[model samples]
Target chain A: MKTSYHKLKNFINTPFGVILLVAAVVFGVEVLVMEFLFVFVPVIQASVPPIAFNFLDAVILTLAVSPALYFLIYQRIHADAEKLRKITESAQDAIIVMDNHGRVSFWNEAAETIFGYTKTEAIGKELHKLIAPEKSLNAFNHNFKGFQETGEGPILESVREVMALRKGGEEFPAELAVSALPINGTWHSVGIVRDITARKKRENLLRERERELTEVNEYLRNKEAKEQALLASLGEGMISTEIGGEIITINRVAEEMLGWKEAELVGKKLIEAIPAISETGNIIPPENRVCLNVTAGACVGPLTDDTSAFVKKNGESVPVAITTTPVIIGGKCSGAVIIFRDITNEKELEKTRRDLLSLASHQLRTPLSGTKWLIETLQREIHGTLTEKQGEYLTQIYKINERMTNLVHDMLGVLRMEGDINPAKIEPVSIQTLFGVITETLGNVAKEKNITLEISKTAESSIDTDSLLLRNILECLISNAINYSNEGGAVLVETKRDGADIVFSVKDSGIGIPADEQRQIFQRFYRATNAKTFDTKGTGLGLYIAATLAKKIGAKLTFESAEDAGTTFFLRLPASAK
Target chain B: MNHVLIVEDEDFLVRALKDNLVSEGHSVAVAMDGEAVFDELKKKKPNLILLDLLLPKKNGFDVLKEIRQSPEWQLIPVVILSNLGEDSEIKKALELGANDYFVKSQHPIQEVIEKVREYLEGKGSTKVGL
Candidate 1:
């Protein structure tokens, strides 16, 4: 019906409908004039008296013409409506038309699909009642009434996302655009709607991704700031460079250490800016530079090559110990960091200390030795036979001198042990000859104590060691054994060959080291709590010196003891190949 | 009787040692320096040498080296007695063929007498000091 009506509407709208209406009106008026003339002629007044009384024919003609004119007008109006329907049907939006009475006058194919109401069922129903949400129905009714009265509505021609109901009674977001169209001197509304649920979901996902990206970017910024702060706050000189050895950053300590400002050193090659100079005043080559080695994925320790110094900007050299590490990421060296400490003052202090120690040993011992010899000469009764009282005083003097000598001697030994000693003079030493010397030195003391001192050598092979150092160690251990043991307690000194090592052990039947104080026995100046009550003269440096000396000579000292029983100390030296 | 040479610069120490050695029935000669030791050696070969390390003009180590330079004097045993009793110095003296070492103040005069007697007894033993 719509297709047929549109064809006729197009024909009338052009020229056919205009000409047909004009011709019908003109023909009706001409017929009326002819009939009036025929009825009003004088010569036929009497003959046509029945004709003048033919008003029924005129009334019948008027009724038939009026009904025909109304049919023509209705057909033309239907044709115009079909043309508007065609425009609305092809649009993507659901086009809904409602008349002045606020009832649904037209629901296009899109409107039927969007709202789930057929055109037949939707027509004559209020438009807002069909699709408006219950929450918005009151507002919609007020706006619709205003629209009908003034041809104005709040949403007219305004596109917005609105909650819309579908035919399945489900609600979804939609984009609605509304406008008023006038026809027959009354206003109708055309509402264009589009489903926007899919668009809204896409927009939401995009917003979430944007937020995540911003958070990640912010976190990275904060981490970078924290790293920068840490690098700037370090106490040791720190220099960082790109993988190519170009200087990228230098901390405040590095600037002060090198005597170059950060701005002056940045972008310069690390090796070029701060040269690694040897103490002998030679510039080191690049391949030998510690930072470059780190950049090449090498883990290099403190580079004190030739007592290395880092030459500063003003041509002064500062002795330093440099250590470099690579900043590795994914198995690649992205950069390198070098940390160095200035040791000039420390080195100077160390040298001064060594000098003072050497002086003390040489100068102080000379006079002390002279005093001891002079006192010993008197005690030998070379001056005369002394009275008992004089003899006792002389003996006291002798003991005091002896104690002083031992203290000075042990103090000097500690100095030497702590400092560098020349490597032990390794030589062939016979255990038989060695023990002979030890026994000869310690036997009288052992005899006085009534402690049987025993010696046994089980190894047939000759042992190699620094004989003097070995003698000192054995002397300390044997003397300690004698000193700590009760009268009549025996001391056993033995030597044997363990696999790859020669084990020399000193076992004593004496007061054992207190369990709690055992670990601290090797520390300098540490005395066992038990020793304080024994009235024995102990330097408290015996075991410390013994242990350190043993270590220097590549030996291990291990001991075992039980309280009130006895203690055994073992010195294990590497069995040397002849 | 053993003839002993006391090569030392200290007169009191020399006099005391000489008195002790004389009482012990050994003839003792005095050399105050390394040069004096050479002069004394030329005058009469001693049976034993008691060498002091820190002597005037020339030390005992040089005197000992000079004495060891000749086979005639090298056979004579020398005992080094000194206040410099550090292991390095002691090892050095022993390495240069001194018979034995004793610290001057560490031991009493009796111990010194004992060490001198041992060397005096082995005057011509000819065993190398090392």
Candidate 2:
């Protein structure tokens, strides 16, 4: 019978059972009514005999039927109640029912899984006693009061990182989402909790990486500051320019050297900053802007070039030796970097070296000159008459002394020319007169070699220069041409004007300078290999002096030479002299 | 005859220079030190003063400076004769109103004489070598 009661409870919970019960009750009532009518009608006919048995009885039976209908409605109400109880117990979510007191009335499978408690153990216990840790047991009272007054509980619906105690008394980080439900006038909170320890660990690692990156950035910033400070404090002059020769930056040393404030020089073009001029009073273009003759038509300016001098803020010129290199970025000439030192001391040292050389040369030439004079005097019998053999001896002495004198003079010329001092007196000199005097002095040497020395004037010219120095330069060139010329070979000295310059050339139809030696022939103490082979008596300083002199005059000493094809040494002098 | 004064600390060179000048027909007086130059100058007016740059007691430049400051001796032409071939010193001397500058190493004794002769005979005498 108890089992039957349970089975009935189970059937009442089903949706189909409700339909079947209603049909059965209706059919049973119909049969019962039929039976009642049969019994009632026989009795009525006997008791009343006529009058058609019954309107009154019929009314009384209808009243009785209404009472039975009321009983049937009550039974349906009880059955619906049983179904609700069964559904509540079988639900997937925990549907706990508690009375006014905080007690666990029910527990479902999900509640057991989440809390690690069985229904038998959890039911009838206070909800806080089973779920809350000892520390949080008191919190439930406060939360319960809030629930009673508000008809709504403090339901945590957010995913919160908190520690939850398992049935085994172990605590773990968990995400708890809690919501309240009202059933039968009581409120209960259902919490969905999840562990999030791994997520927390990943967040911590990302935070650490950000800190490390910030530290690296700080370190780099400090390092950059230190390097920038070091560069700013460097003692030497530092200047950087753009490819167009515009000054980009300069340091304090450069400002002082230029005699300008830092503001004045930066961003100014190099040429505009200093309009430098050569010795002949002609402006020399900036080195970057200079073009070689062969490439003049197609050449563009270089980003970097070197120069020997610069003009200062006060318009005074100073000697400087600069080395410039291109600041290339991505294979393009972005700008230039120039490192220069004030070469005033270097210039002085150079001058001293030259002076010493000249002094030594002078000392040597003094003796040679004296020897020559004595030899000549003896040869001419100025001191006394000479015998034929004595005259021959005197002639040999004169020849040797003359050679020594020429070598010493050439050396002296080189030494003096190399000095930093400009030796020109810069007086107006007629080219014809100067040429006449020079050739006249060298004519005897040419005669001895039987070389024809011809001077031809392509243009009449005048130059303001030191006549004595000019004479020395001309003598050296003419002598070089004559000495190298073979017997009866013609040596031509030509003068012509090209644009604003006066050009002088000594052309010889004899042993020419070799191509290899020509480039270095102008170096101090450097002699052409061919010249050394042909004339062992010549000092190597002649061409060096000529080049120096040419530089002093703001002229270019250029030459065209070939082995055994003869050579032409040309001096391009400016029309104006300083 | 041009009257010349030779101021040199080197007695041997001064003697030789004086003798050479004397033989070339010039009246010559000599001062071995800068102090004696002023005193000698007052006694006899010279046509030219061949001044040495280095001297005892007072340098030649100072002596020249003193002479230039003085009214009586300022008209006498002074020529700087020195072995100090430095450009700055020469330029300073000239700018300080020295009449002429010549480096002894560059010119022989004969060339010196010729230069002196030419200067004495030219219009520059009044301003320089007179």
What are the TM-scores, per candidate, against the unseen true structure? 0.66, 0.45
Supply candidate 2's per-residue lDDT for A553. Answer: 62
**Which pairs clash in the backbone of model 2?**
A156-A178, B47-B130
Q: What is candidate 1's local distance difference test score?
A: 0.78
Mark the regions of model 2 whose C-alpha exceeds 4 Å error after superposition. Answer: A1-494, A506-521, A526-539, A548-554, A559-568, A573-578, B86-101, B120-130
Flag clash pairs in model 1: A157-A178
Local accuracy of candidate 1 as per-residue lDDT tens digits, A175-242: 99889876444668877888787888898889898999899989999999998888888878888888
Please state the Cα-based DockQ of model 2 relative to the true two-chain complex: 0.05
Residue A242 lDDT (model 2): 72
Measured against the true two-chain complex, the DockQ scores of the candidates, in the order shown, are 0.26, 0.05
Measured over the true interface residues after superposition, the C-alpha RMSD of each candidate is 3.2, 7.7
Report the C-alpha lDDT of model 2 over A330-397, residue by residue, as the tens digit: 86666776655677787678767866764575356445544543454344443467888988887777
